[model samples]
Target: MVAEKDANAAKEILQQFEAARTQVGELVTAAEKNNQHFDQLIAADNAAGHAIINQAIMALVAQTGSIERAAGIIGIDNLNPDTADHEF
Candidate 1:
């Protein structure tokens, strides 16, 4: 009778282990899916940041070109900050 009781207990333990393993597998799958979504969001955010940087760089290049052209037209090819007079 004691041996029969021990066998039953062993069977119960095995069932509990199987349930726990199933739960752990589900949790791991959820975590992997969440990680994939997180990676996609990070990639999109990085792409947007790079786009903003590119726009700012283009704007700066255009502004610099405009300033150089204007300076050349006004006969100020090289304005020395140390010796130039600033009165505003």
Candidate 2:
């Protein structure tokens, strides 16, 4: 009878461990999805900012007739949109 009781207790412990592991796995999956969504949003925002900067650079060049002067107004050395770094 004591052996039967111990076996039942062991089974219960095993079930609890499995439940905890499943819960942790679900949490990790959710977190990964959230991170991906956040990354997409950041990328879209960066692209939009890049477009606006290019527009401003073009307008400045048209008005000033000098790309260097436009770049100096924005406090950057080179305003070339194609080669500019967009890291923030």
Candidate 3:
């Protein structure tokens, strides 16, 4: 009778382990989806920031009447050419 009880307990433990594994898989899937959505949001925010910077730079250029002068005033002209090219 004790052996039979032990077998039953082992079966119960196996069931619980399966259930926990399934829950962990579901959590991982949800986390991956959340990360994908967060990445998209970050990309959109970066694009918006770039757009705002471009607009401001254009406005400055209009006021200054020369892109070079505008860049000089904003210190963009002082940046390393390679770094400035990559950033813009």
Candidate 4:
């Protein structure tokens, strides 16, 4: 009877070990999913940043076009004076 009790205790210990290992496995899976989410966020942020830059560039192009059209109507030269000396 004593040997049977010892065997039962060992079996309980083995069960506990398996349970602990299962918990660890679950945690590892969760961590991997979290890492993938982080990577997706980083990629999305980069794409958004590029979109913002593209919008700014488009806005600047529109503004410059307006300036040139206004200058053409007024018959005024819009040349920069800083580089005018190099033309000679």
lDDT score for candidate 3 against the true structure: 0.44
TM-score of 1: 0.37
**Candidate 1: tens digits of C-alpha lDDT, residues 1-88:** 3224455544544554455555444434534764433244345556643443444445444444444544454456785433135331
Query: What's the residue-level lDDT of 34 in candidate 3?
Result: 44
Looking at model 3, the pairs that clash are: none
Per-residue error at 41 for model 4, in Å?
13
Candidate 3, 34-85: lDDT as tens digits:
4433244345556643443455444433333333433454456653333344
72 in model 3: Cα distance from truth in Å? Answer: 77
Query: What TM-score does prediction 4 earn?
Result: 0.36
Against the hidden reference, what TM-scores do the models get?
A: 0.37, 0.32, 0.31, 0.36
9-76 per-residue lDDT for model 4 (tens digits): 44544554455555444434534764433244335556643443444445444444444444444556
Alpha carbon lDDT at 75, candidate 1: 59
lDDT of 4 at 53: 41
Clashes of each: 0, 0, 0, 0
